[model samples]
Target: MQKLSELDHQRRIRLVDLHEPQFERDYPHIDRNAALAALHGELPDGQVLKGLDTSHRAWSLVGRGWLTAPLRWPLLRLVADGCYRLFARHRYRISLWLTGRARCDGNRCGPKT
Candidate 1:
């Protein structure tokens, strides 16, 4: 019964889990145009700017993920995925808090309710 019950939470958790690391790995590369789009709610359209994301940590940490889900298609999706990488920021990384650096959940995420 324990296994069966966890199975349900598994789906929802997995949905977030499955996409987390993919974002973490690709976050550093979030381009400038993408950053501007995130900031202004509009794409570069025709601008040619580079080096937009020198500090990927800021948006990924303070910013929210679901807010960027609308862009989950084509090139824009990559930017959305960058949001996930925010969790990987060194300050929030699991190892920084945990003793052995093992698995992390709601408890490990931050202060408890």
Candidate 2:
């Protein structure tokens, strides 16, 4: 997330900590429990979007837009979604293997639970 925030030179993305006290007050429409379980997005118009597809679309705004452009193709999008799910499911384990840490502390990766 820090890397992605740095890449967002326009400062368009707001990184909100789910555990923060003000999270519910600020994003009243979002269900904290569900958000902790998966990626979620609240658009400017208050539309709540979820899953890796929404995440990739949001990433398109940054310099990495080209990477997600292939998602326009239906087949590639389907494959990408599957890969995203797999990654999300085992991300903590993958982080442990790659970085020698669970990467869950400080809510850096995702919910501790």
Candidate 3:
């Protein structure tokens, strides 16, 4: 997310961390559980877009439009969506393995009491 923000030279993208207390208050229209479970984007018009749709739009804003342009093809889009789902499903474990910790703060990723 930091990398993407840096690439967004125009400052058009606003990356909100789902763990923030103000998230629910700020985006009451979005489902907290659903947003926590996957990637989500709240457009300026208040539309809550999710998953690969949000990703492509964000990438385009960061000047990496070519990265998701392949999704314009129906077949490629289907395949990419499937892959994204797979990754999202296991993201926590993957992050732990890669970073030696979850991507989120310890309180959020730690075992519930």
TM-score of each: 0.23, 0.79, 0.84
After superposition, candidate 1 runs with Cα above 4 Å error: 1-69, 88-107
C-alpha RMSD between model 2 and the true structure: 3.4
Give residue 106's lDDT in candidate 3 (0 to 100). 52
Arranged by TM-score with the best first, the candidates are: 3, 2, 1
User: Could you give candidate 1's per-residue lDDT for residues 21-84 as a string of tens digits?
Assistant: 4644644444433443332111235332222231222222334334434555477757654754
Clash-forming residue pairs, model 1: 32-52
How well does candidate 3 score on lDDT at residue 36? 63
The model with the greatest TM-score is: 3
Where is model 2 poorest over a 10-residue stretch in terms of lDDT? 104-113
Candidate 3's residue-wise lDDT over 22-99, tens digit each? Answer: 988988888877876678997888887788888888999888978878975698888988888888888888988987
Backbone collision count in every prediction?
1, 0, 0
Tens digit per residue, CA lDDT, model 2, 1-113: 76788888998888898878899999888898778766788778877777765677578768686776786578787887777778877878888898776767764655345
Rank the candidate models, highest lDDT first. 3, 2, 1
Q: What C-alpha lDDT do the candidate models reach, one value each?
A: 0.36, 0.76, 0.80
